[model samples]
Target: MSLEIKEQSEVSPFLSDAARSAAIDNKEKEIKDAQHENDDIMCGFWIFKGPLLQRFATETMYVTIYGVSGCFMAMCFAYFSGTITTLEKRYKIPTKTLGIISVGNDMTTMFGSALIGYYLRKVHRPRWMGIGLFTIVIFCLLNCSLHFIYGAGEDALKLTREFGDLQNITGNLTGSHKDQKLCMSEESTCMQENSIWGPQLILFGAQFILGIGQALFIVIGLAYMDDNTTKSKTPAMLSFSTFLRMLGPAVGYSLASVCLRWYIDPTTEPLIKPEDPRWLGAYWIGWLILAAITFLIACLMTLFPKELPSTRARRLKCEKDDIQNPMDQQMDLSLSGMWCSLKHLATNKVYVYNTFASILYFFGYMVYWIFTPKYIETQYQQSASMATMATGTVALGFSAGGVLLSGYIVSKYQPSARSMAAWNAIVDFLTVAGILCYVVIGCEGSDKLSSMAVTSADSCSASCHCEYVHYAPICSPNNDTYISACHAGCTDNTKDQLGRTLYTGCQCIAPSNSTSVPELQYAVDGPCHVDCFNQFLIFLAVMCFLKLVGASSKSTNLLIALRCIPPEEKSFALGVGSMVASLLGFIPSPIFYGWLIDKYCLVWGKTCSNKGNCWLYDTQALR
Candidate 1:
């Protein structure tokens, strides 16, 4: 390809001399024209330019807040399954029925995201943002109402029991005598029986709405940035935007943690009986606030001066001119272009290796994010707050390391796309080492709870207990005790036992002198230590890092690829690359993560059980 291009360029280089002077004159004129056009645009955009950063800052803030709210809601939705379990126990609904609803919600959100992406591309940015936010607000309002209804019903149930109205409650609460009989016999026919289903549906619906909002926000924001910035400045602006997007989640999670601590009570029963309902109010409140902010930002987006003069005016002027019609430049959404780009990418050995390595890294990451938090919670028996803090710690490490190292490398080495790819590969390799360390901790059965407690004390209050303890059957030389208690005396205890207590000038007690207690540690366990529940969180975190690296490198590589084409072909090459990424690289991501999680867990379970440590087969052991 290079040789062919060179030969063509040589033939066109006016080696025959007559066209050489003409070509030079044309090039000089083109440069001068381009410079003059740029100056005209710049001068017009600059009159109110000082406030641009302020606008950017405000928009960024709103986006960040909304980003956090969206994530928190998603996590809440994910954890809603736990709420369903509680609701089922209280209301007597079949678990399978609830599972169907949960799965349905996820599917709906996926479709919603794609739909939103398509629409955002089709519509104006402000309209898209407004529509997305409005949808979210409506859905969230419905969700909040559902939660209130459910809570009221639960309150009524308590009121009836307290007032000795149980007998009369049968007819009013249950639909018929048969329902009363079923309620008494099966203990599942309460008025709030379908309460959980409502909120879940609402959440699922809200997720779809939020997904649309997110897609609009990202796509429109990127397009706006691209349209407004100078060509030379676009890459830097995009990179900065990506950085902010990444940072937004971390900041949002941190703020959410603080809010949870301030408003939520972990020890008490949830306001709606099952724990899931407790989070619903808080979740909706966050969404409502975020939705308002999003709406405001959507309104503000209208203030951004349109880059081009009104299209309607231009169309009118064109009609008056009766100019010859330009070629209809329809968007080419074809497989052939994608295939060519894929072929081009594959032919470049460095890019091929980097891309595959990125996929592998993301696979590992998705698994880690999915399982790690649950592993930390179950293995260490820590509180949700603590689990979040632990995960945040790791995330902080990643952010810090990425920022520091990437900046240093960019400053010092000024590496090319291939170099960035190699560096990213190295980071993935190092992440594997971190995972191994976590695995070792899990194997050692070290005190993950105490360690996390200490780590979290800085972020959380001293009174907050973050330890998660799992009680496993301990085989001993003496008669086997049905229950073994490992007590960490962070709080006032009703029972006292013998154990090693580690403390930081606070009254603390550990499980008594029991050898070979089924202990699990997180920091030492690596990715192997993450439990089933947390596998998703681990998987998400890992995938985020890997994707960041891959996407960044890919952008640079695509630019390099564009350079390989003739000047007139550059735009075509770029369009082809984008099509390839959207078609081949985008579609299978979810399926790949799902497969990796299932396969890894299956393998991990088999290995753990076959090695004669059946207790280790527990999903918590990995966390």
Candidate 2:
């Protein structure tokens, strides 16, 4: 019995050592397996599936690509805004028609956002975004193709007569001007040669396609960012992206200013100066640049994996922790499941309130965004290029700064959702008050063209056929502006020392009691001086302030919407919110503002007897 016990004790030690070795081996295998899983992802066997590729699969990399693409997208829109006036002139589109074209994007969003938001939740997000961007590339090319299709209509002053020829001077100015000859002639009606429908349909179609491409940016992009980041870090990341996005407009408007300085058709030299109201800018050049950048962005977006590396790790951990918890289960894809998910959101009061607030805000905000450049041009008599540059540099720059500062504060303090809401409320009230100031701001418009009120038979130059002239104005030294040199009764035109056209022998400059001025009278080219520089400066200051305060709420509002929804419904909520906002806000805002603008038109450029673009606006009524 003693010998058997001694043998068993020695064997027991060997068995125990073997067991410990096996356990250690198993643990080491698990560690290696986990490391392997994290180091590599199953995106594909192509370039997307490499250890080297994994190095770039980070939040920082994602944010960078997203920001640059966002900049390009924003640049396209800003360029459109900057060049809208020139487009109006080039196409002979009235403000009301222009407004209809502007709303085409929102119309698609109003219908498609809900579907995109809900169905795109589990798909490869970056690849889908890439598809959307590709569509945008198409939109850019298509929209700009209009200029190539229809040439920038002939310059208004392109005369067939030789220099010093006075015959047929009282003819239709190229699109926007009229001149009167010393020799009186019978009036003739101009024939309608251009079709407005062609240009209008093309623009609307382009914006509609653009709307489809923009969905990914509005819905998926936000959710992707929030998913990859911690709750506390999300605001900072969003602010960074938005700040970069805002820079796009600044650069875009600056580019517009540069492009507009050149004639509409770069191949041809313009006879009329850019200072003349008839100038058409080179608006198509920027679209080609935007298309090339978007193609590169598309390639980058496709290379990213379905889920980011960090997000994948967290998701795996979460699945393990909540393996038995039904409430933590992933969303269901069945029809009934979707209905239930939607119902859950429908009942969510916080989401409902936040969405309504967004709708109201966007409704009021889009008008200013779409028309500010045109407003600046008409109200202050600033050039289109100057107005666009100012809107982008001063207004959009201050907005970007405000968003960045707000994000920094939120990130540093990690404020609660309620606190964010309270801050937004204060900002909202301040915004309303600031916008009201624009109503009180004022500037005098062009001297009412007295020629329009009188018949040529009763006028000082009774023989002049002024009825057939266009709406181009000529400024007299008396600070009065006539509809045209013909209306001013100028018998001859000559060049000045500075090379500007000078009209001489003007009968219209005589005092009210005198039949005509006996002395030689003269006037210069272009409109009379508008003393609104001081008022414009004040308007700019107010605009800067309003943009600053209004933009501060962007991050806060987004954070509030995110926090109020269930984790799985983040994308769906954003999509639905955007859909509602489009239906109630963006879809109608531009049209309403456009109609209001058309109502104040004092002089419309006539295109074959149909009312065309407004040459002059009632500045007071506009305010």
**Root-mean-square deviation per candidate:** 16.2, 7.9
Model 2 residue pairs with clashes: 156-174
Which ten-residue region of model 1 has the weakest summed lDDT? 520-529
For model 1, the stretches where C-alpha displacement exceeds 4 angstroms are: 1-123, 126-146, 152-197, 262-284, 308-361, 367-372, 397-414, 443-623
The TM-score obtained by model 2 is 0.85
Model 2, 125-227: lDDT tens digits are 8888888889889888987899879876643324212311332354433223333333134563553746778888999999998888888777888888888
**lDDT per model vs. reference:** 0.38, 0.76
What are the per-model numbers of colliding residue pairs? Answer: 45, 1
lDDT of 2 at 255: 83
Residue-by-residue lDDT tens digits, candidate 1, 1-623:
67445444545653557676566566667768866644322211334444343344333343343334334333333333222323332322332333333333334334454334333343345445545545555554654554345553332233223322453455453344223111022223222123334555664565455545544444444444443344454344444444444444454444434434432222233312211112211322443454455455445443333232233244447668985323113433355644554465457665445445544554455433333433454454333444454455346435534543444445455566667556565666766665665543432222332233233324222233221221111111221211112112122112114321112111222233553232311011011121333544454465346434433443343334433443322333333333333334333443454333333221110111121001112332333
For residue 342, give model 1's deviation from the true position in Å: 11
TM-score against truth, every candidate: 0.50, 0.85
